[model samples]
Target: MDVLSLIGIILAFVAILGGNYLEGGHVGALLNGPAALIVLGGTLAAAFVQAPMSVFKRALSIISWIFFPPKVDLIGGINRVIGWSMTARKEGLLGLEAVADSEPDPYARKGLQLLVDGAEPEAIRSILEVDLYTQEGRDISAAKVFESMGGYAPTIGIIGAVMGLIHVMGNLADPSMLGSGIAVAFVATIYGVAFANLLLLPIANKLKAVVLRQSRYREMVLEGILSIAEGENPRSIELKLQGFMG
Candidate 1:
């Protein structure tokens, strides 16, 4: 799942770096440790300051989702729901005990439990929807931390550039060193923009995309549970659930 995401990021770096190298730009000039520290380190520090500890932790955790997102098997999910619906119709609530016990996803497990407990469709829908929305809210919050970091990185880079230029100004007595000094001073600006666009902003967007996919899956599961509780036939439930595939 994350293979393509990894390739895209690598390709982006290669395109820019390779192009610069071909044009006689030394890659080592962009390797200023202080510039990276200001842009990336300060961004993380700002994230820690801006978000609650828990939210920040969750944001850190979801960073990997940019590379390896959760798999959503919509077709398989629908087929499972259809099977459950058939069992519920033919063998009644008790028939779902085995399936419910075997279910792995907590949301789906909870739904099956409610079904076997004879929960009214409305009550089941209310509970599951609340859980779904609450989870989505947390995921959104996590994504926002990265978005905020992206906002900070560019400005932080500018600060780094200004500081570098201040040092450069102090060395004006050395004419031979002036050109290198000016180049080093501007690397901070490049660091800030590149980190923000190529990594931070993209990571935030990817995390949001993962959250969106998860939300859709949860909504589909909730719909399936409600359809089953409403005593809809397996064929009808299958038809309704198939819409989630898209």
Candidate 2:
């Protein structure tokens, strides 16, 4: 679990609410249904229009990564690569067939299968690089979905504010309606800006970071598999793969 992300979320709310309290503003003042509906609904509608169904689904699927990221155990991965290297050296590439059959990660399994099939080093590199970059591109695109939402949210908020002001202008004769109109106007702006900065954009960036980390781990696996296919010494493979850690 990401304790920092959890803390950040709590802190963001506390800071905003605490600051509001200090300024003699009650929580109820910020709670405007129309403003929230306008900002959140319009922002989501814009995001839906911008992203394809596949990418939108991908974004939703990976959203949990902000709090529960996929594991990237570099040390353990390096050890597995070394073990594969030792196996290949002991009994040739064919020996990896059994290991490949039982490998859990699809990316690593594909590489192992290629090595076991006696694929050339260049072929292995080409195949795995395609897989690596393709996946990275997809995940990066998914992360950008949140980025697009962030971009739209603030503008939608402004629209809400303008709409509220228009309503205020229309009801100038009614003094009773003025307070609610103005509240919605300002609160809509706050909601839009706060959601973009504190949530959407941060989620986008964090997902991107997670995607890159996964790509790096896959890259390490690819390099290690290629080294084994080329008959590199286990020690040299270990040393080379360690470079990825930094």
Candidate 3:
């Protein structure tokens, strides 16, 4: 779990609520259900319209990465690559057949299979780069779904604010209701701005970071597999792969 992400969420709530309290405002003032509904519902509706079904589904699936990110072990990857290099050196390229079979990562496994089949280095690079970039593009598109939501949220909030003000305008004859009505109208704006900055945008950026790290890991794997295909020394392969760590 990402302890920092947990802390950030808790702190965001505390900061907003605590600041409201310190301003001589009560919690109930910010608990306008209509405002929340307008902001959240409208924002989601806008997001649904803008993102394709696949991208939207991908966004939903990866959102949990904010707290429980996919692991990317750079040191471990380098070590694994070195091991593959050694195996290939001693038993030849065909020796990687067993390693390919047992490899856990589908990306790495595909690269290993290519090596085991005695693919030319350029052929392996071409195949793996396509796989790498295709997956990266898909994931980046998913992250952009959340980013699109973030961009839409503030404007949707403004719309909510306008709708609320229209309601306030309709009730101008009731002077006693004016204060609360106006407050409710502005709450939508607060919800919109806060939701976008605190949650949606942050989620998108974090998911992007996770995707990029995964891509880098795959790139490292691809490089290792290519090196083995070209019959490079394990020590040289280790040094080359270590550059990815930095």
**Ordered list by lDDT, greatest first:** 2, 3, 1
- Report the lDDT tens digits of candidate 2 across residue range 33-143: 999999999999999999999999999999999999999999999999999999999998999999999999999999999988888999999999999999999999999
- Top TM-score model: 2
- The lDDT leader among the candidates is 2
lDDT of each: 0.87, 0.95, 0.90
* Candidate 1 lDDT tens digits, 133-170: 99999999999998998899889888878887877788
TM-score, structure 1 vs. true = 0.94
- Per-candidate clashes come to 0, 0, 0
Which run of 10 residues does model 2 get worst, by summed lDDT? 112-121
Residue-pair clashes, model 2:
0
* TM-scores for every predicted model: 0.94, 0.98, 0.97
**Order of models, best TM-score first:** 2, 3, 1
